[model samples]
Target: MAVVNIRRDVEDQFYRYRMPLLQTKIEGRGNGIKTVVPNMSDIARALSRPPTYPTKFFGFELGAQTQVDDKNDRYIVNGAHQADALRKLLDDFITKFVLCGSCKNPETDLKIMKDGMIIRDCKACGKRSDVDMRHKLTTFITKNPPPKKAKGSKGAGKAAGQSVEADGEGVASDEEDDDEMAKQIAKEAKDTPIAKTGKDADENVEWSVDTSEAAVRERAAQALSGSMQASLVLTPGDDEEEGEDENSPYSIFNQWLLANRPGGDEGRDDLASAEIYKKAQELGIEKKYKAVQVLLQALLTENAPAEVPKYGAVIAKMTTSEKHQKAALGAIERLAGITYPSLVPNGVPKILMALYQLDVLEEEVVQTWGKHVSKKYVDKETSKKVRKAAAPFLTWLEEADDDDEEEDLDDL
Candidate 1:
């Protein structure tokens, strides 16, 4: 079993990370031709994905149905596929799912967020990159979520806490009584007169809770009856603040966009961006340039930079400070160079230049970013490629600085 770099572009035989070459077998007659990926399980193990994912990707690419036989480790595609073609498709899978979008490293884990967005957590660079939501695989990953960890695992406590929080306020299956109480409370609130003045008046008004002897007896009787149980009243503000406290504005906006998205894939990026802008305005955070940072994070994925400018107008309106600008640029670095290198197009230098001209990023920061290379996200060669992409911007910044220095000397 000869091994090769997960990224075949790196032909280095000594590349540390390696996977076995794809092996395929063609079987059956003309009408029933099918391709079996004999070593797909082994390949998937190397790539750290469920074998079915790649098998399904094969089916998707070849326009054929696929059968994943996990029990026997047999994955079959309806049409006969060449080993080379499958290998190429496997590379596509690596780019989209396996490899870290930032560093281009294959060491990553898939995390499905609560809002149904899939993120890749890169082990090497310690950066979490979002997967593009527009892909067909996102729907599959959401429905057929990754298996839950063993109860005693490190995340067990967090999962349990989340479960408890979800249980708060809204009991999923409460019968007639809870509904009746809610209606009674609504009726009382509607009937209650508004106070003309505050301070001395009804500053703190309690909702619905009966403290009478008869009410107590009724509750006791219900408990005793075994047919009914006491329903707990949650604090009014508790559940309302849960969404805000637990999630960032960007996260909420992202979920909202996903839910209320328009029909058809045409101009989806534009529509999503417009919706985000609308949300920002509604929340009164539109003027906060930092809002654009959140928007940038939610909208842009390693493989999808086309939507980067969707919020460009909103970003331009903000009076961003140097610190905020640096943070925004850092987000781009994480997305383009570190988390998703291959997916980031060559226009990154142009994007940086545009931002620099707009005063969104300073020359010093841009130069520093270009010169600093981290192999954690990529191999030396790929790191060099990232640096090369930043070269033009770095050169322009250097020349500008030199010209300024010369002008100062002439003034003296």
Candidate 2:
């Protein structure tokens, strides 16, 4: 029954949001050993999610199979795991799926956008941060969506909405009616005791007609029930009825570029490379590569020469053909001359090596290009510096060919 902060890192005892400490029980033995989350429902209820969600998350993180039995309220994971480990993993799940990226608040809801993207809409900040599409759980959430709640149901709409007390009121009213009926029956019994003997002697005594207590109680109960019935009734249902237009990957890529234009002014042609790379991820896995040209340009201008390998990995994946490879190398060469600080003395060499390892740049093209000096970015001095940085890598590339030939001969 002890409580801890939902975000345990806050370390504040007075924090409003809390849940019971995770309770896990180990079961079975040897190969059949498993972990049962005894209080998963309680924890999930506190987190406003189905017990299956956290249970499934545990399976995913721990590389185990999970079973969610709602009927029996039993959630089991296939291997023994410590309570502390699962609790830590739960925090990561909260970060990825529960909390809003922009506001870092847990008061958010998962919504599948028209484009099949999961977005977290923050109630506190009113920002819709797109969930990274690459996570494995995205597939699960998309398939098994939460059930839609009825509109008029208690706790139906806003997280902070009040619940109707009709059930409680009805019970209270029924109890009062029963109590009143009991008192009336006792009073009538006391007042009209021994009527048989009285009837024989009552010829001279006047008698008044009155309904029995049982009849009065039935009439009063019926009237009270009729008054409690509601005059108007409303049913709630899911309202996400409309579908959204499906834009092509290219169009989406363009839209992403337009929305994240470097400066506030649309006229400005330049943009920050890091920002572009970050936003391009939202275009999903398909169209991310198309942004490589702009991404490379931005990185060349904005990122330090030594940072080429960092962004190079991203842009390298976009290269699908010999032409794209040449273009990427050409972009690097062109950016080499720009007045902006040239890559560190060996930045180009590092970029080439990474791309080559990723199979994005061909050995033949790199060898040919390294042999020739090109000035396209800024001026002679900067271009010279760029080539000098690439010299060591170029020497290695040439020597690598001889080594490859020697290996082939030895194999022969």
Candidate 3:
């Protein structure tokens, strides 16, 4: 079987992540037709995910029903999907679930928290990234979690950071071959007479570090500069001060919103927005485009469509250019598509309309945003869905522009 990089987008031939090429076979006739993935288990094992995940993802993407028989190792999706089509869809699945958000490495483990949130813990970068819970497959994964690995088991050992040697074909070499090779090497070592030179004797001796106070002080004096020594000395409450600065400005702002519960009380909205703006200024991130995204995400609630106008003053203050407006739109994409997906397919139009009415987003920017769907803030699928929800509002804007042109002609 031919293998490809798990992240097929990567053209590097030597990429460590590899999986078998997806193979799809059409079965049955007419309405009963189905696509069967014979080697899904093998591919899923390579990805460190359950075989049912990609299978279900295919169903969701293609608008088809899927069936998984774990005992028989059969995964099927209704409808005759071609191999290339399934392969393309599989890439999207890998992007949304397999790849680490921070490092883009596929070496991650999906962990479900007690709060019912799913996160991917990357083994390579040691970053924990939240999985977009809005995707339909997340509910299935939550209900039918991946099987836990048993302690000291071969699979567990492999999963727990053990490196397995693979052959040219990208398959793990047989354990029997390793055992035989080890035994042969041991026999040859025993048969040969041992020669111990001075260097060899030295290699056999263990090394230890000197830890006496005098030795430590001497080493510190030689290595540490005055500034370095002064920096190492911390006074009381220094840890708390350092911890506050350790968090990103956006993260700190989010925590502040949670603690203050802004936008909950009437007539205090402007005061809250002003305080938020002051906080942004104090953090020195007031001019950053990302601050707009964080602001919208932190301030907007599930009823974002209605609340957008309420916070219009703050939005106008933060978004001074097209780039900032785009960031604000990206925030809406994340909010509707990932954070509050339940409001999608209806809430987006109202939200966009509110922004347009408040002049927070320009007509040109809105038109450009509706025309292109990118995976900058959300997955491509979610991006497309969010844009689709905004289609009606976009159409209305276009029609209004055309009507204005006709009115100008009549005036002439």
Candidate 4:
């Protein structure tokens, strides 16, 4: 991965090192002649040149800024385009966040690549589009940041050891209880007090077990009588039922909606999935920013299939989700309200969350920025080559429309 810091490290340097260069050299800081120089070489030329549009210089043509009435128009149009691009690079590097390509959406699933080009698919549309490197230029300088790790710590290994200890305790259920039934039963009764009278602790009595030879024989005979002569009883394993809808009432809901998220649409009734609605609510989707987004996707409307992620109770059951049963009740709240009116607000948050999930500022990121990079950053020889690299991502957006079936994160 290319080394880059999305928030601080790169931003700190861009302001200190790169920005000063632009202020003192290109903008002139009130010291001298204003002109457009093509490349860094032409930057030193200092010859007077024409004024030009930002996008026009790179051959893409984004648009224009306020015009300087006093300066010569010719000087405004030349190498100024490249200088402006360099400035944008610094600004983007210093940015706190970057948005998705199509919608300029900051909250996304992740960056995706199609045809060997990196693009960001919208969390809302599921349609892939080119990444907008223009917003934070340093993001481009270090396109893929180095993976971060902590010093003197083994995160995964440490967690595994704790898990193994827990597993050992859990395995007790599988081990055979070899102790004689009478003695074993006596130990359980003596150790674990039972509430026979319900309220007063003093009302409970200590269990009395007789280990006398006659008593042991009596208990042994009863146990043997209860034992099967040729035992063949089968108990279903819970692990076998996992990921299967065979015995679960909510399993159908899991299959139809919650599990198809992230990869693609699963053709389910997302709105009707009452169980998932409850999951989002109990997880505090109505309160936290990111949780709100995750919840909204679970309750999406018309354009459903375009964006959804798989979800599992174990995975989704974070601190954000406490009221799983409550959230589920809310999912079908609206339908219930139509009949009883009280159920209206039960899952109304789910609908509102889904609504806020909509995004719109994305398409313009590429068309405007793509041109500037070519003229300013790309060498004349290579500018032609790099411009086409953004094509695959942009082309996909121009062709695809959203569908209606969506999935929740449980599927993953």
Candidate 5:
């Protein structure tokens, strides 16, 4: 029956977000022992996540099987776990899957995109954050998405401005208020001479327009002399300008990434990977591989080597194919060689290693990138310089591959 702050780290006594303390009851004996979370539904309700999610997370963390009895409101995990231990594990679940990456608020909803990516849509900050797709629990969540709320429910009625009284009387909603205001306006308008007899009264008033040729010429002369006429004049580069505007989504996303860089705020990291993905969705570029390229160029700065790992989850979710991997490499090329030329000789290797470690760039893709210098991302000379800078890392990857191949031969 005891309650605790949903985010245990936020020890503010007046914190609004609170959940029931996790209760574990162990059943059976020896190998048949299982840990049961009696108040998991209560905890999950407070967290706004399904009960099975945390239960499955416990199973993954403890290397045990989990069972869910939705009808009985029961969740079981094989192997006996203490309340404190399970509570700690639940905190891990909250950190990874519950808290928003931007504001650390727990008022977030887990949304599974059509691409099978799970993102936390934070209601507090209105930022969408990506979950670490590499986690095993993501697979389970994708398979079993949260149930959709029924339409036209009480909550929907309230949202739509429908109010109900305790005595079953219906109050005037926003629509009714607007209708009354409109009727009052019409009645007031009828008192005036303009609305006294509708169109018949208006015809009694005389109105005329000067559409003579001399008058038209005078109007044209005035318009031509005005500053507004400049906008009407078309130039040879109008098509190109219009095209650039058409591609403004990528530019807009890039500007957002630049403005909201991680560590921009004091004592907080603003790595809004899910927010970036959400922006891509809004721009209709979530499925485009090129969007990943924009993310790389916009996010990583001079300290790209240190920053790449922080956005690993973001890159992993966006880069799902070899083309995306290559696009990511192109962004890196532009970053080290063109954007920050000081990173040419030394920082490039570390950046490559970071991306490799995060599994954002595959071995073969890196090798292929290092083998040739194309003018696709940067000028040929800059491309060559970037490739030259990446040689040491490329050599290391080749050596590692050769060792792997040698091990295969020895086994054969």
Candidate 6:
């Protein structure tokens, strides 16, 4: 199919579309009076190519295609994507023709050239001004032939880069007027014969409309997919306390991170932000440190039954040798309320074996009289309270007590 531009007189369709300056000046030789004219070369160069400026011109894709007649002698200028040709045609027409028709006005206007035509003013009627619609500046382009085109141009008769055939037909070679790409397809379809009612021609072309719709849908989905653009590497102590939506990528990514822990397979060594985030979340919830303390209290600290594992090693890093006694005292205070008294059934033997190593220090209350030792210094009630606190753990005392109890029957 052939490509055609808007008919003469419509340059604004494409060319002359640049941002107009408050006062733009046009170069001139100043034959008599000075006036401005547009840069024809600049307009020509801009129109001859596709994507000359924006992706589109006047809302029409410069390189879009349209359907046209395929007759060898007859020329049909398709309405779609013809702005480039339309614009050039108008520019040429306007440039060559000038002067107002209403009054046979002189060429005072820079756009028009006057040849001293008779003034069509109503001199008898108080010189009332009148117009000549036939030879007006704007309409003159329509009456005259379009500007001559250079040889080798694609669609010469129509506009820039356009070529006309021997039959006076124009061909739009999209390379010259890329917009004709679709137009060419239209011509092929028109020239091809139609099949029987149910038969189809070129299934690919038939699916084109659907494919184009799918493309648009995909683009929209991608645009609306992700969270707001933010730093992917989330910082600790981030303001997560703010009311967060369940669908937040941060939360989703955090869950994903927990599913995959740290130090996984070597192939997974390169974790993304989503994975690392999940791992960090899991660590917060595991509370591994507090868990170990609870089990240790059940064994050595609270005298509960089941033998807990060697906590000394698990907590070795937390409390060193110099601080072991102090740490043990602290552990006792923390475990006092946490009761898991079923250790006897699960594992108390190993616990007692390890506990045999602790010192049985007791609280002592004594009163001394200036460097003199006294029998009344230790009281019975204070002695009773100290022994009661450690009564369950003082298993070694039984053997010592046996010696005293041997004569208890006679004493009682």
| RMSD vs true structure, all candidates | 25.7, 38.1, 29.6, 27.1, 25.5, 41.4
Superior by TM-score: candidate 4 or candidate 5? 5
User: Candidate 5's C-alpha lDDT?
Assistant: 0.68
lDDT of 4: 0.29
Tens digit per residue, CA lDDT, model 2, 232-328: 0111112211111225333444445443444322655545555555555554322322234334543443243345555555565566666456556
Candidate 4, 348-373: lDDT as tens digits: 32222222222211334433332332
C-alpha lDDT score of every prediction, in listed order:
0.56, 0.56, 0.68, 0.29, 0.68, 0.28
Give the CA lDDT, 0 to 100, for residue 89 in model 2: 90
**Would you list the clashing residue pairs of candidate 3?**
none
Task: Point out the higher-scoring one by lDDT: 1 or 5.
Answer: 5
How high a TM-score does candidate 4 get?
Answer: 0.20
- TM-score (C-alpha, index-matched) for candidate 1: 0.38
Query: Where is model 1 poorest over a 10-residue stretch in terms of lDDT?
Result: 227-236
Candidate 6 per-residue C-alpha lDDT over 159-277 given as tens digits, one digit per residue, 9 for 90 to 100: 22233453233222211222233233333333332232212233433222345888868643432221111112121111111222344333443334323322222324333433332
> Which residue pairs in model 5 clash with each other?
128-274, 128-275, 129-274, 130-274
Position 158, candidate 6: lDDT: 22
Displacement of residue 163 (Cα, Å) in model 2 is 15
Return the TM-score for candidate 2, rounded to 2 decimals: 0.39
TM per candidate: 0.38, 0.39, 0.40, 0.20, 0.41, 0.17
lDDT, model 6: 0.28
lDDT string, candidate 5, 1-412, tens digits? 9999999988898876788999999999999999899988888877767788999999999999999986798899999889999999999999999999988978677889988899997644557899999999999988888655322122100111112243123222211223343334334333322221111233554556599999978754543232122211111110011122223555666656655675332333676678778877787556555567778876776677778777787888888888788778877776676556656666777788777887878988777666654655566667666766666666667667788999999999
Output the better candidate (1/6) by TM-score: 1
Order the candidates by TM-score, highest first — what do you get?
A: 5, 3, 2, 1, 4, 6
Model 1 lDDT per residue over 49-71, tens place: 67777888777777899998887
